[model samples]
Target chain A: MIELQQINRIFTVGDQQVHALDHVDLSIQSGEYLSIMGPSGSGKSTLLNIIGLLDRPTSGTYLLEQHNVTSMNDDTLAHTRRNKIGFVFQFFQLLPRLTALENVELPMVLEGIPPAERRQAATETLNTMGLGERLHHRPDQLSGGQRQRVAIARATIMKPAVILADEPTGNLDRHSGKDVIELLEQLNKTNMTLIIVTHDPEIGLRATRQIRMVDGRVMEDNHKR
Target chain B: MNTPDFIRLTLTAITAHRLRTALTVLGISIGIAAVVLLTSIGEGIHRFVLSEFTQFGTTIIGINPGKATTAGGSIGVFGTERPLTIDDALALQRIPNVQAVVPVVQGNAEVEAKGRGRRTTVYGVTSGFPEAFRFDTAIGKFLPADDPQAPRALAVLGDKLRTELFGNENPMGQRIRIGGDRYRVVGAMQPKGQILGFDLDDTVYIPTRRAMQMFNRESLMEIDVMYREGTAEKIIVKDIKRILQARHGKEDFTITTQQQMLDVLSSVLNILTFAVGALGGISLLVGAVGIATIMTMAVRERTAEIGLLRALGAHQKQVLTLFLGEAVVLAAIGGFVGLAIGVLGAQLLHMALPAMPVHTPWIYVVFAEALAISIGLLAGVLPARHAAAMDPVTALRAE
Candidate 1:
């Protein structure tokens, strides 16, 4: 679970000061599938980054399971982020030099997990993601769908509590996009917090909870049965 | 990382850019070669001079008429006025370590043959001069000891002077005119070519008695003495000076020994060798610059890879060490290869030019190698810092 109270984020470009997030307050229970919809410059990505702790708010409080992580040092924040948070970006950010298996195993290696266990866990994770046979293929050598699949497999390797996917299907064809969203939804069904940032209305409508933003403030936060 | 794995990684990365790595290493090789070649020349000349000087009879000491300061700033052979006499020679021969005493008188004279004439410097020496010089005559016997008494008008020609003035004729008992006198050739000096390009084979030697008589000098101006080996030349010089002071009642003569000659030769060589080594250091400087530039480019090129590694939780220190490792590896390899090449190159040069001995100072080569590697490591430091200092977020944001 996560809580936010009057969170605000500001950015300055040259002489003009811009408020990216303004007095935002929100809450998400565990296992919630949330889609944040916004027009260009709508502060959806900024809000997601703050929630993911990749960016800090200019003011106000953010409580992730009652931990006020805003004041934590970089090392402590990194440790918390590594253990509990995973990110699936629009570009699929898999290292081009590494094969699918190696990329999936990266988070475990970063956690200082032993080699044998890391490889074995990475293998099982890949098999569950239907990429066992394609484990040795590098990102460039794989299809867009396959790379996204490998990215998703990597993002979940640490069994993180939260998954933030910012336009994960942005670069995929429609069929692959459908498969990626459906797979994320499956993870959400298993009590994993899933927050998808996107501009697609059709994709936004399928979420159990939807928040729409325009300019810098939230326009709507609607929960659907 | 463990040392073996780190070494393997460095090797793999270098091998990935084989051409660039080889070129960088070649830069260091040239620096090493320059040092080796220059030092060899210096050492070769030194050894040649030393060997020749030793061969010309080191036990002999010459008292020249002029003040003799060393070529370098070591001993000052300071005295003037041609202050020696035959009485000094006679007194010096009575010293404890004294073996032979010879007085030499000399001048330049023109001798002619078939309308061809060349001026050659001639030495006027006693029969004792040949004994002091340890020269063996091959063609004819040395002049008798009674020559100083009867004062025979006979001469001994050097190998080159013999060929020049006689042209294959047995000039023995034949007359050649020089210095207002016609002297018969008594014996020829054995062949000894040159010392540091100074011709040893052009001089003509005649009896010192005849020389003093011709030059119209009643006393000896230069006294040459020979001493027994393992006897301190200084002690013998002291003995001669003591006897001379007692006889002439004045301390005004100078003595030179073989050890002094060797010292002068060493100092001359050290300067030349140091200059050459310094010049080669400039090339090594260029090689260091090469390493810095290459490391900078490598860091710039690997920006994304660095971001990727940081994303994998590599610390800033680890990233810095990786780049530093690459540089250190490059330098260490270059140093090892350069040392081998430099030493072998010096030896090969010696073989190629047998007349010029190419002396390889292994200590110097080792020092150069150590410096080169240190330069390599130092050169990489800044670039490695740049790579390590990059912000992962910003780097990832950069295309």
Candidate 2:
């Protein structure tokens, strides 16, 4: 479960203050599959970043599992991000120096998991993502589809309560993008809360719940299932 | 991260740019090698000088005529001081712990033997000269003990002088003219090599009284007293001063213990070694600069990696440690290589030129290694700090 009360994110560009998120309020129950659809500069990605704890809101009272996460320190926020949420970026920000398995094992490595156990888990996760043969390949050596799959494997390896995907298929072909969306939907079917921020209406329609934003405010919220 | 993982991470980073890493390592190694080689030679020379000075035996004391105190005016401003006499040498023999005393007078003289003539140093010393100065005869006996005030016409040829004048012929019974005085050669000294630039083997020795006459000087040049090994120098010096003062009614002689001379010599040699080492340290400073430059570049190039590590939950200290580890490892490897090369080179030099001493003290080796490592750590500080302080979001976005 997540809740945001009067969340506001403001950025100062030279002389003007841009309201990226303006007095926004929203709530979502556990295991709900939601998609945030909006045009450029509509605060969709900004909202996702705030939920992922990668960027702090200028003013917010964000509650996750009834705990006010907005007041936590940087280190505490990092720990929470590591344990409670996972992020899949549009550019697939996998470390180029590491192999696919190593990329997936990174979150567990940060959690201080034993090497043998983390390796085994990473191998299994890569295999389940249809990348068993590409386990030792670096991101540069893999195809776009395989790289996105590796990113997805890495995101879900920690089994976080919420998976925030900000245009996960933005850089992939239509077929790979469809496969990535299906993989995310499969995870959501297993009772994981999945939130996607994208401009694709097809991917937006596949979500059980959809929210549309315009000019930094949530304008429409619909539950389809 | 575990230690092995952390080290591997650093190793991977370094190995990624092999040429750069090798060049940096080479810089440090060259610096360490220079330090080790120069210090080894410096230490070797230090020991060599000390041994050469001590070869005459450290238990002896030389009493030179005239007080060493500087007068108000220039040279000869102070009227001729009383010279140390044979009686003064005899008086010193009466002191406790005194084993032997040799009243010495020295001058350059032309000596003729078997129609060959050469000008060389001539020493006028009593029979106790050999014992007091640790000199030994090669083929014949040293000078016989004769009266200090009156002795027979006898001469002892140094090894080199005997070869020059006698040409391997038995010179024991031969007559040699020293300063126009014909004296029978009684003995030939063994080869004692040079000490402080004076060739001991290129001189001749004669009786002190005859030598005083030959040199046309009434004052003995110096009176050397050899004391027992266990006796303290202070006690022996005190006794010598007392009797000489009693006889002359004042202290007109300066007594120099071997220990005092050696202390001065060793201190000067220590300074020489330290100066040489410091010169070598300049090269090491250059090496450190090289490391700093490389590390700065590495930090700039790996901004994204640093950001990724932070995103993976590595603490700022961990990032700092990773970069610092790479630098230290580079320095340590370079230092080890340099030490090996330097020590080997010194040994080879010692073999090639046996006269030039080449000793590598272990303490200097360890010190050089520690210095190299510290240089690396210091050089890594600024760059590592920059890497550690980078914002994860901004760093990840770097191209």
Candidate 3:
């Protein structure tokens, strides 16, 4: 459902050129659970960002669901991202001023969904994440684990085909980290494709497809499924 | 996004920083209040002056002897300028829509009545002075319609002058001496208040021909012609000029219509109102700068949120509108508050000093509010554009 051909992401810092992603080629099918593991500056996050449509490669042709998304305009790209992809960041990215329910309703708000309906959907999604009683709690009021759960609810509210999570469990305690992985795996069981970028080997190895990147290139690709 | 949600979002951002928003709003309100208050006083004075001038009626024209033209050199009395006489005043009555014509000759002279004497303004005018100038008599009557070239030596005492000279005794039919000439008092005029510090109620009125002879002047100072309302001034002025030119064999008189004076007065007053309004606009400009500064800071502080909104599929226009909405709402609120304060302040001032005139036209109120909104739009544009143009990736990374 997603494809990239010879993607290159180069950054110019003053006089030197840095290749964040060099001649990278990758493809993923529907319902696939994948992980990109590498050290800092290995460009795993850059690759994930490229796949999420958050960053454009200097030279590449990207096809999402067989539509050429590489040459799409900014507004079209934004619309594609909204309808087909969801992102969960290491920082959770929940607006500090909004409650958990409101944070989860953000994507639908952008979609111009009716208030009563979006509110109902957000409540049910939070309830299923075991946050029924904490729906009105702000991010500052919730624990690290509960906040990640709210972020996950927010990401999946639009039912995007692919989820891009960059260090989703990086900020949580070990116990809560395990809980977040379990929640993501639970979504994978429902046929939602999930892609995780992490430095931790334990979490990285849980995916059906694991790829290790080094020096802006894929060093290893293993399929356990 | 829907309008309600958009407004709700903007309001949430504004309410997050309550103190800053309030201070910015206060800045704008003060500017608007100054505009309203100053313009009110300006407009009030405008109307007040106009009423004072128009009280004598607006359809009268004054023809003064000697052309008021800019001459190359001082000719003194050697210039062959014909004096406006009682015959010239009579010739003006031939014009269309002519109502009453009064030949005017004025001077200061000592008047003695019932053994009391004082110097006062003496107006040499015919019977039509009352009708031409809208002056009324309190007791008896105004000057009789005696012959303009040769009239009886009759006098009319002003309300104030009658009280000073007679002391409860009727001045009518009593003898008074004006410029060493004895005249019988015909009437006492009602109290017509002062105009521009000139005491109209402290003057005496006598026949124009008699005063012209008493003052030993060849010219009738001015010939005032009152015409029926709704007659175009140009027609009467042309007729007066033609007749005067024919009699004097040249245009030696300057005819001034009341409307022309009013037009000049109206323009001067308009400029005064605009000048004061512009002064208020300076403060409003400062308020606009305040809004711009606050909006810029807001955009800088909310970079991550803007990125989040963009990632959530909000258009650039939406982001721009969000920030602009905050600014416009701030200005609009300030405008309403300022309007209330300004109007209330003007009323309070009027009450505290009843002599000071104050009027706030509804148009100015509407304009002030509209100006506030425009200021918001102008000030918010740069910051809002900056916010909208920010890259989502870079903005999301901002702390």
Question: Each model's C-alpha lDDT?
Answer: 0.78, 0.88, 0.91
Question: After superposing candidate 2, which stretches have Cα over 4 Å from the reference?
Answer: A63-71, A108-112, A156-159, A189-192, B70-81, B228-231, B348-355
Candidate 3: residue B25 lDDT (0-100)? 95
Could you estimate the TM-score for every candidate? 0.70, 0.89, 0.95
Where does candidate 1 chain B have its weakest 10-residue lDDT segment? Answer: B73-82
For A108-127, candidate 3 gives per-residue lDDT tens digits of 98888899999999999999
Query: Residue B148 CA error for candidate 2 (Å)?
Result: 2.8
Question: Candidate 2 lDDT, tens digit per residue, B343-376?
Answer: 9998999999998998999999999999889999
Docking quality (DockQ) of candidate 3: 0.64
lDDT of 1 by residue, B150-177 (tens): 5677788788888887788886776776
Model 1 chain A lowest lDDT segment of ten: A73-82
Clash pairs detected, candidate 2: none
List of chain B TM-scores, one per candidate: 0.80, 0.94, 0.96
Real contacts recovered, all predictions: 0.07, 0.24, 0.49
Question: What TM-score does candidate 2 reach?
Answer: 0.89
> Which one is best on TM-score?
3
List ranges where model 1 is wrong by over 4 Å: A1-12, A18-89, A92-139, A145-168, A174-225, B4-62, B66-82, B89-104, B109-120, B124-157, B162-190, B205-211, B217-269, B276-290, B328-360
